[model samples]
Target: MELGVNIWSFIDRILCWRQPCACCGAPGRALLCPGCLADLPRLDNPCRRCAEPLPAGATPLCPRCLGPRPPAFARVHALFAYAPPVDRLITGLKYHGRWEAARLLGSLLGEALAGADPLPDILVPVPLHPRRLRRRGYNQALELARHAAARAGLPLEAGRCRRVRHGPPQAGQDAAARRRAVRDAFAVDGRVDGLHVGLVDDVVTTAATVNELARVLRRAGAREVSVWCAARAGRTSGT
Candidate 1:
């Protein structure tokens, strides 16, 4: 089995060798060139609680997510820090209607979480309000979740939750402001009773949004919730 896996990996590498790097225009590179891959700002050392970046050899949890009134979600998992090229990737999918970008980002997150010790039973994409959905023509989170569910083989439940309130964007909001912005923002529409749910989103900043969703999910009978984002912004996002 090991030898067969290695052989297939070698063949895949050969096939990918001819594709251009996604971020850089480097020729004859795989999904990303080696340099871009190394510089991707991977959150390999994340807080066990919020998935925030931690110093090498530091404790498992971040100070912000440590205090009382802990998050409704069990934990967060992510693949990258929301930095330059990574930000570009997210924005491309979010604003430019780039479906391929969603495919790349979602597949990356899904594959990373595929080997998670305890995977969630269902994946739920954060919903967009009806007005925003009509304006944007699609829910970016759902787009991301579709590819993630396909890659990870996790069942996706899109209608379980809905955004009942459409407030101002959470961008540029501090933690307190974010908490306020998302207050009563979500409503549970379908049954999630006694299930472990993986909340899928494009990015996680202070986590105010997902935490609110988790809160609603729990009230709707979710056993546990965890966040899975393509990227995690730094402390500057009010983390």
Candidate 2:
């Protein structure tokens, strides 16, 4: 049995090696080449609650998300603002069949989790409803969480929570409308008692979705919930 397991593991690694890196097109580079990895647009100064770009020395939460405190925790950390090259990368992942982008994004998320002042006990990817999952043929958050879990050395509970409803995309909705659309959309599948859960998502805009998911997790006995996202979209016409 041990020898068979070792052989399988070796075969898996070989298969992985044949895939091209998602960024920079380097061979045997996991998902991103070193050059592309170095070029990721990292946010140096961002709003605390939403990760929006802020002027140097500015307050954490932007004026918008602060008028009323968010339903989730008081802080959110995003790796980059949703713009330009980063935006293009995300679009490629979502629409252009670039699944390897998830690996690159996950590595960045793992770094962010490592540098966090407070770390979570477990990582949970925001789940897609069954219908949506079938329609899209993949869940980007799950792909990211798998890579991030390995890099962070944290347990990932992919089945601990689930999306119970099929709701419209939160984009193009006002804050209030977003809240209504996502409210009670998530359900906890197992015990999270006393655990600090980190919720992972591909992007954050109004944050209504994360807020609702956090509420359900907390109600299910999670001690605390923190949200992490790859990008934070600025308030645009749809937002």
Alpha-carbon lDDT of model 2: 0.78
Name model 2 segments beyond 4 Å from true: 1-33, 55-57, 237-239
TM-score of 2: 0.82
lDDT of 1 by residue, 161-220 (tens): 999999887787788888998999999987788999999999898888999999999999
Per-candidate local distance difference test: 0.85, 0.78
The TM-scores, one per candidate, come to 0.86, 0.82
Sequence-dependent TM-score of model 1: 0.86
Off by over 4 Å in 1: 1-19, 28-31, 55-58, 237-239
Name the weakest run of 10 consecutive residues (lDDT summed) in model 2. 21-30
Who wins the TM-score comparison? 1
* Shift of residue 183 alpha carbon in model 1, Å: 0.9
Root-mean-square deviation of each candidate, in angstroms?
5.4, 3.2
Cα lDDT tens digits, model 2, 1-239, are: 99996897687566567566555567763655667667777776777776767778888767866776555654676877776567777777765656557767887788888877688999999899999888888888888787788778889999888899889976677778888888788999977899999998888877788888888888889888998888887656263
